[model samples]
Target: MGVMYRPPNSGQDQGHKMHHKIESACQKGKVTVIMGDFNMQVDWVNNAASGPKEREFIECLQEGVLEQLVMEPTREQAILDLVLCNEPDLIKDLKVREHFGGSDHNVVEFNLQFERKKVESDVKVLQLNKGNYRGMREELMKIDWEQSLVGKTVEQQWQEFLGVIEDTVQRFIPKKRKVIRGEIRQPWLTKEVGECIKAKEKAYNVAKSSGKSEDWEGYKNKPRITKREIRKERINYEGRLASNIRNDSKSFFKYIKNKREAKVDIGPLQNDAGNLVMGDQEIAEELNKYFASVFTVENMSNMPTIQESQGAESNMVAITKEKVLEKLRGLKIGKSLL
Candidate 1:
């Protein structure tokens, strides 16, 4: 899903850039949907020739294999609003509703036609705090790796050692699965806020049925109180996160990352054939193929001799373990996606 709003005063340059970006998104070969107040006066329904900018934008959609779904006029008579999708049947029952709020453009409502993807979250985790660390240590200490792996190949030796460690962990560690009934509510939602929410719902229902002024006023006042309670609870919860960061840095960092609203997941990708790849294995293979195609590794064994420029001398030196270690020690560790 994508949203865009191109200003009317902007010239062809901005439009071209926006078109390129949208085209690239479509190239990802995902279940794509792009909607915006494009400000393009294109006659998509009648197949009439559009202006320079409109033609360029339409050409881009064509090149990217995108289909325009919205046909009705959104703002006055001209079709300034558009809903573009790569899949022809992905968008269904698109309705042009009345003007939304103070906006002049009509609200375009549509249902996406596809099975919603369910993301699997962890239900069970290793309970490291209850693990038998002493037993594991004693068991590991009993193994004489040098004598046991004396004649094995390096890979085989490493595998055998890994197998022992895994067995030891399994024997000593404990894990439990949690049963989650529904989507987990926010940790910040306290009893006061929950009660406020219930009161607000009750007031709304009473006001809707009676249509009394006092009942409506009672309903209206509930939101302000609810908001205040919610604000206080959230601040208290965040304060707790900050205070406990040393002991639970992961939770604190996770909350901070969520607040940042960053998209970290690898989006739907496609191979050279332009077919959607969704499965983890398939996506990985497609990415590998793309990276392999882009990156060409040269054979360093065949070196080319280059003549040094005049007045320039080579100052190459052999790398030492101490020097490498010193450089590594000076380097700062950073968080990276890789």
Candidate 2:
């Protein structure tokens, strides 16, 4: 269960999806040994930022009871290559070898002696297509909310609302649950990079057969330069995305927001009585109680009131169709409706 060369700038959504896929696979495998080029430069020793994808990968390993074996830098200057195992003690002689086989990724060597356990896992994932939000809205509009909620208690009303929304989601969006198998693909591994890698491989084979030092050196240097080119292309691709901030502002902002979405998984929390509360119901109740106490008013007295100063001119202007149209025109185009 090794991942090689993750998409660098595919954004956080893909990274999270990839992490979950890997985690699910690890869970099902009896003796999991996940390795390969994660492309995340993590300084686990120094408590440094390892980017969102790397952080998620680390969290996945933690939750799955997996331990990373490779501790040294495997790439040029970064520990991009990783080797993880469920039984850290079982994984012995874990080290990064020199670049081999015409590849830029350094080889990770490890030994493990454990019986493969047969584990069954079922993962039900709800995937959403937010792009079809217009269709979702149309479905919602077709439902008579007032009629559905009529003659019901507050709790019943809430239940009805949830039921309708869940049903709508099932209808409008597609969902599937199945046995988890790790099958992650790198979309950013473009054809050009593929050709460059192939060329390096051909160079390596030729050097090996001819026993030429220059050819071997070329094999080594070619892959490095190719990797650099691939990296440059990826960076340039992100630069194009940055340029979209003006022309395609909605997508630009959405990308930024998704990239920064919280990956932290908050587990069970303790209540005031020091009892650990789990599940949605207990968590919501605890949160509501805490907020209610914080916002509770003691005595309602001497409240401040607003009074207009004498001779102060009112800034309110009369609404006009032309003024409204002008304002609308002034607003930036391609902005999200909501």
Candidate 3:
């Protein structure tokens, strides 16, 4: 059975979960040959060779216990294709083959031999920190540690300060981990690449339109069809037409080549802030200002308001084990902290 587009919803965590499920199924006396376009690369490969997203996928596969068969030299050349087997020794001779399907991906073939054994259940439990210490350190460092609070009570300022620390640290925490098993049977294309292709097509159309208009305007009042003249005209027109077509084809392929080169640099593109948040820097600056604003107190007495609004409420609310667990799961799954 072929499965496709197994969602990487849990990111690395999902990879782990999928790994467990595959192992479980195989251990039950089933000779499982999991094959598909995983849409991921292995972590042992560099990001430049695998791309960041592919690298993350590779990390997931490693965490989940799946091994990659092909090792493409670069991420651009990296194949989304894969074939995995519970019985590796049986299909050690398998190799990739070319097909005439006109598809971007080539067909893969492998053989497998299965031998049942008493499978031992291994539970690898990892303990992770509940709080983001690096985030907490960064947030604490942002505070005006030497700022004086003349009017506010010590309790108020303390509360406000604590709130800032907690909020900043929480922002760095991961939210979920998911396990995904399957293949990308369909081609995995990014929007950026798609848009680039469209742009190239548009450019080609524009060139074609310009050429037609120029030809028509140049020969608008030419003589009506005469046997010899028509033949000559036909020859001239055909030559120009073929030239334009060649140029258009060249232009189109050039566009694609440029787009592919641009795609090779997509590692930094994944970290783009605009893609993740609206007005990223502005929002970050605004948040910093908001936190800074609360810390300022004209008098010691004024600190209570900041404290009450920020600190007191924070203290009243508690993060339960379920919430922490959820966060751990999220982190495992590849959720990013903003």
Candidate 4:
């Protein structure tokens, strides 16, 4: 989504430059939507543009395979606001009826045509936090591993142990159900704002068909009041979020996280197979393979110019459990923290 605002009467050069930038942007993105106040006085009925710059703008947009969706006048007699997309079917139900609070420009409401699959996790898991640890420990202690594993192979014994532990967990531990987190709601959206938006929509609908100047005047004044209310509500919302952040830090950080674009820590890397490795693990593996290829085995036969230490010529001994216990016994741990 590219947001743009070109000031009115800003020269033709600036318009050309902006169009060039938009063209460049369209070329890079798979699906692009450039929106906002372009301030172009276009004669959509006759398929004509007023100035040379507007004509060039339309030509440049077409060269880039872009489509301007807005046909109605967003501000008074000229269509200042515009919504453009590279793909023809990328934008759907493009409506220019409603006005946003505080702006003279009519709001362009539309939905991007796509399907986003919700990535749900597995259904059930152990809630260890609420588990009966004492009961589980007692149940485990009752199992005699020596006799249990006497006639079983290593793999069989492992399986048997796992089965017993699973049974114990089911008996003692509670289950947790994983669900998707709540969606990020707009911070500025309030009950008052919602009512105002509905009113603007209703007013716009009436003004479109009705010839009454009173109806047009009524619709025009709604936005100014709505904008003021929006500002107040937005400030209050932000203030509450700031003040209660310490108590509800998850929501605050989640909002922050949602605002920022997802970071690509590891970029696509080409592996030995000439295929792009996109995942973090795959990229790590590719890097590891590259690093492993550069490593050379050192020749032990030809040692470096250094003498071996001969100060302590004692032979090392094998470590036994008995020796470890004896060492522990010898320690003066009377005042040890542990």
Model 3, residue 192: distance off in Å is 42
Candidate 3, 195: how far from true, in Å? 39
Q: Which candidate gets the maximum TM-score versus the true structure? A: 4
Candidate 2: residue 239 lDDT (0-100):
78
Q: Candidate 2: deviation at residue 232, Å?
A: 1.2
lDDT at 71, model 3: 47
lDDT of 4 at 23: 83
Q: Against the hidden true structure, what lDDT does model 2 obtain? A: 0.73
Q: Which parts of model 3 are misplaced by more than 4 Å?
A: 1-4, 7-31, 43-65, 72-76, 114-338
lDDT of the candidates, in the order given:
0.81, 0.73, 0.51, 0.81
* Per-residue lDDT of candidate 2, residues 207-324 (tens digit): 6578688887777687677778788777776677787776777666665676685866555889989999989778887888888988868666977888878886889989999998
lDDT of 3 at 310: 44
* Model 3 residue 129 lDDT score: 60
Better of 2 and 4 by lDDT: 4
Return the clash pairs for model 4, or none: none
What lDDT does candidate 1 reach at residue 308? 68
Candidate 3 accuracy as TM-score: 0.26
Tens-place lDDT digits, model 3, residues 265-335: 21212122444333655556556655787884678554554333444333377789999888776552222
Model 4 misplaced regions, further than 4 Å: 26-29, 115-178, 181-183, 186-193, 231-338
Ranking according to TM-score, highest score first: 4, 2, 1, 3
